[model samples]
Target: MKSLMPYLKARTVEELWEYHTKLMQSYGFDRLIYAYTCFQSAQSLTNPEDALILTNYPSEYIEAYIGHGLFRDAPMMKWASRNVGAISWRYMWDDPDNTPLGATRRELMALNKRFGITCGYTISFPMAIKRSAAGIGLVARAGMTQNDVDALWEDKGEELEIINQVAHLAITQLPATGQSRILTPRQSEVLELVADGKSVRDIALLLGRKVATVDKHLRGARESLGVETTAQAVRKASVLNQIFIVDPGTQLS
Candidate 1:
């Protein structure tokens, strides 16, 4: 599989998603879905019953899934929420005690029969430091043999793992409330350094600027971000995910 290290430096969120979608297609899978719970704040107790789903599934299939609330009934949810590995629906649906989703289950089966799809492989990961989870599911069609699964397993395991990590970062940095704000490259840089506990002098030295200049940059960051102190600027930036707070110097390509 191709390395996704370059996407870690992606200048925008759209670029990240584009890179991820391309990576999924490279795995020889017919369909891919990435889903995450929505959050309101760091301290939010419940997720407000909303999620983001990115997939290549046809519009009708998506409509059917949502119309039936399959996300709530999907057997994959049971394993994904608790188990970290891939799960097979055939095994999950076969377990009688589990109470399979009746309508949705039939729909999925019919989908397979109609579209020649057969197996599914799902990988789940924790999204944030808080209570959210993220998952990606790859669907294999009827003609796909063991060799196909093996090929993907061998070639794309690391790629999927890296995608999981990137998804986590994206979720952690996602805004929790209100209208979001955009940050200029310089403002993002200064706030990120501040959040990492860098002093003005050190930031200036590293950025090859005078201390006074760095302080001015910080002031601009504070105003543009609509915060008061440098600490607040840092905190807001972290909350808004305008930049990577942990390693401020890391630049997105």
Candidate 2:
């Protein structure tokens, strides 16, 4: 792999994603889906809208996976959620007895098979925070079988893991500006103060606004972020890098 210093210094999430996708493609993984969320719960990712999803997967597949909320049924998603580090997709297919695969795996498997995405690998990055996680799925190129993926992985697995781990680290540091419009300036300000351990009255005092107005902003932020409370909004915004920024990221205006 080329020097990943450029990718580490990527100015925008889009730039990093583009570079990472191309990098993976060069190694024969033609499609990728990078997902991260701070709003993760014990069962689900909480909400698809809250996720930072960077993908080069087919639109039709993406539509079903995320748009139609089929990601909940995705076999790799299940694996990534439970474990860290890399795992081959061959395990699921090889296990005909379906000991590891779930009840919904059949449907998702059929969908993936239809799209020629039968072989791939999922790397679940380690997370320090209990409620946050990040992972990537590398779909093997068309006409590649599980055996082909196995051979490729055996040869280049170490380099691939290092590159992807670097990408994951770099990505988490960058602002997820794709959801920039999810909060207005006032809403973001309120959330930032909230994240700083400010109460409503304290935030109002700091922002030179009425407590009621601050509450309104907080409420708006929660609603916009699809969270039920201000604390949740703060956590979500902080995870997305929509709050507590020193140097703002790109395309956030």
Best lDDT among the predictions, by candidate number: 2
Runs in model 2 lying further than 4 Å from the true structure: 94-103, 248-253
lDDT measured at residue 42 in model 2 versus the true structure, 0 to 100: 91
TM-score of 1: 0.57
Model 1 has a clash total of 1
TM-score of each: 0.57, 0.89
Please give, for residues 1-253, the per-residue lDDT of candidate 1 as tens digits: 4665756565444556666666666665667776665332443322323444566777777776655555555566555655565554455455434664577677766765565545656787754445555677777755776556756667666666666566546644544223334567778887778877888888999899999988888888888766678886775566556676344356567
Please give, for residues 1-253, the per-residue lDDT of candidate 2 as tens digits. Answer: 6678877678778888888888888889989998998778896655788788888887888888788777886767877777899999977555433677665667677888898888889999999998787899998998888899989999999899999999988887777846545678778887877877788999888878899999888888888877897777887887877776656443555
Model 1: residue 241 alpha-carbon error in angstroms = 5.3
Cα lDDT of candidate 2 equals: 0.81
